[model samples]
Target: MSSGSNSARRVASLLRPSIIDSGVCRSCQETIGRRSYATATPAATESTTTPPVVTPAYTINAGVVLSRPPQITRELEPFEKAFFFYQKRLNERLALPFTKYFYFKRGTPADEDWKKKIQERRTAARDIGKYNAYDSDAWNDELLLGAEQSEPANQVEALVQDAESTANATSQDTSKKEDIPRPYPRITEADQKNDQKSLNRLLSRTLYLLVQSKEGNWKFPTSPVETGETLRLAAERTLSESAGVNMNTWMVGYHPVGWHKFNAPRAKKGETAKPDASGSKVFFLKSRIMAGQADLSINTQNLKDFKWLAKEELPQYLNTQYYSNIKNMLADR
Candidate 1:
């Protein structure tokens, strides 16, 4: 072929448009629709020096350029694009100072009311503290000032002053008084023997076994009746307070009653054994579990370990030292 003809054919081939149906055209059409049309001229060259056609690295729509080209890199799904627009609008709204201010004080009035109430409460508490004096000198001064203002010559006034002075003196004396120590009861030899017999009888009585946890340890809830409270009440309260278990009904059986005394070497000097005081009372009381009485409050204050065991399993469940009582109780049952 002639050189001019060959050159003409090459230019024509490069200029010819690639065939594109609706689907392929739609992809490019969307980007073209959003951008301003530009006329780009093909450069003329004879030595095959064709300048590269620089297509957009990203898709453009309505003057908006995507960072990553949706058509070429990764096309965004409709939902994804919708989400992007939503996030874009959200960011734009957040940038506005008015929007920020509106949200900042949205519930501020209610919060302010709460803060005001708290301040008022604090003020009242301070006022109460101001009235309650801790210093003895301040209290005495107030009392004396009140007394001095009274008419001393009048008999009624003198009487009132005397009463006030007496009351003040009593108050001061009461504040100075030492805490009274509880005196241990004295047990005579006859009483001790009687108590021993009573204890033996108590031991022979039936007792319901219940385990409770206290201070990370397990302790049997047993007590002798003394002072004001009954044995049953004492046992129940001790169990409840220590192990969180409430004893409802007891199935008392034959239990041994015994009295045992030990001279505690740890007792302080001059601390003689008081007569009429029983060393210990051992008794058995039978009881049953009550529903809804199980303590669910988790506290290590009084107890730590706990379990309920049947009479048959008592030997295996309890330590060896506790077996004798369990065995006797079961035999009695």
Candidate 2:
């Protein structure tokens, strides 16, 4: 024990200068002989806690505007120039400028005077060497400022003669249904705006006279104006529901023009049919179609097929009075 104590004192004395007296503190000196002083480190008695992680540095500047983010989920259907016809005048009337189209049902009054006006216009177009233009591509930008041409006097004799014959027939038989005069001349009318692509992929706006199907159908996509609805809204709803009009297809152009009226048979079922007096009035809204592939899947109306045709091509497909009605409203760009 005496020899071991003497050896420990000698080792402590040797470590005193370097571990305690020269640089190391008093606590290190006390541990020199008891434990190895090879490398200095924090004591084993230290806590088991981990150091906190630092975040990436960022600086917000003063006066930097922080706009609120847009709500993507609440995005609504767009209207007008916001979606189509990027180069149109604001507040300007939207005009597709269709050739006014109409057709008389069988047993309806046929006006020959109206026929003369249409023939005149067709002749005038041919006289001007615009026969090709009559069938060619156009933007329908024609400035038409005059009143519609009046029906000619030539048909007055024919109308009176027909009336006399009808009167004589009625006088002969009071039981005949045709003897009673109708409040309105039964007819059906439609706007015929045609859309098709030219050879160069240019969009064409030719007018067409669509033929009625075998069951007597083919009418414009239209509906009655609901209560508290504006004309524009009603037209929009009608076109959307009846024609599958989508935002990408057409742009609603202007306030509706005056309503077009036509007559029809009563909607009553399983009974003797009556005249639809006060006739059906359809409000027209001119619209520019951006493309042709319209979603024509109307579940409610009977529409079989459609095609776009120029006005010159309509003579073979349309009745004379109906063609006359269209010609009176026709203009050129």
Candidate 3:
């Protein structure tokens, strides 16, 4: 073969064809074509291309972003549709009909059977003298006296033995001689003068009754008793420091000391335990303002507000739950 032809053949062998016309190999094309008479379709000779479709990236409905198409129809089961309808109806009926129905059923008895049963039970039970009057014997005595007395008898004369006795016995229960009022405890002028020194000594030890304030969330002022200080001393100091008011007269009444106990969660074990809690003793001191004394200078920094309320109006202002103790204290005063 010529050198030019050989070079051309070698180049053709190295290059792969863009498409194959048949299943037969190019190297054994003539031999296969002769042996197999069957024909095969040829593959595509070049790359295929198609245009891309452009769809929306997003949709908006009433300013809300939507990434998918909205459904044209909602699919719900028969029972679900019925349940939704029933719920809507129930809500509407609840406004009036349901409440009325509840009250009607509660007020109206089921039948007359229950009422009949109740009446039968009541009749079967024993009759006790529950309505018997307490002063029946007294009324019988008056009636008997009326029959015996005939001295131009009036209603008053018949019921009573005499006008004085009737008035005393019925009005004031002063039938007993001891029921008469006694004279007040008297102090002679001489005794009073002699005991003036002793009275002054007793008054010096007396503590005053003062309240701090009950404003801006009511809270009682309290202070721990200092060394060598008594409970009375602590109360006096607390009142003085908080309200700037000094008390000279200690109240002569048994003041109630309210106490309470509560359980709080323990920090270490995550459990609750009872802790002792107690309230200060509230004293009812019957006191008068000292002559020429100025208005109390309240420590506004500690107490938000302060007032000296009258004893009579205290009940209306005080908490009803704590009124019992306060009332007893005031009563004693």
Clashes of 1: 39
Model 1 over residues 1-333: C-alpha lDDT tens digits? 799999988785465423353544765656654555346868866687778765432221110000101112223444554454344334543444443224345468765674454344322111111121212322331222223222222323333444454465567566553332333223335345644211121222232333444434232444344467554555454445544543344423323232222222344687874433333334434444433233426423344444443344455555565455345534332
Measured on C-alpha atoms, candidate 1 has an lDDT of 0.38
Q: Best candidate, lDDT-wise?
A: 2
**Per-model RMSD to reference:** 39.5, 30.1, 36.2
lDDT tens digits by residue: candidate 2, 1-333: 599999988896875555636577777777764775555766789779998764323211111000111112222123321322222211122332332224433343453443444444332221211121223333332322321211112123334444554476558576654433433211212222223211111113234323233365543345666667776666566555544544244434545533444555465777864433344555555554443433546634455554444445556655564445444433321
TM-score on alpha carbons, each prediction: 0.26, 0.32, 0.25
Which is the winner by TM-score between candidate 2 and candidate 3?
Answer: 2
Better by lDDT, candidate 3 or 1:
1
Q: Candidate 3, residues 1-333: lDDT per residue as tens digits?
A: 899999987776555332254654776665544553335878868858666754323221110000111112233344554454344333443333333234345345643454444344331111111111112331221122223222222222323323333355467545453233333222335335643212221221221222334354322344445667554555556545654554343322222233212123344676443333233333222333332221335553355543333244345444555454444433221
Q: Clashes in model 2: which pairs? A: none
Q: For every model in order, what is the number of clashing pairs?
A: 39, 0, 0
In model 2, the runs with Cα more than 4 Å from the true position are: 1-214, 250-252, 264-278, 315-323
The numbered model that scores best in TM-score is 2
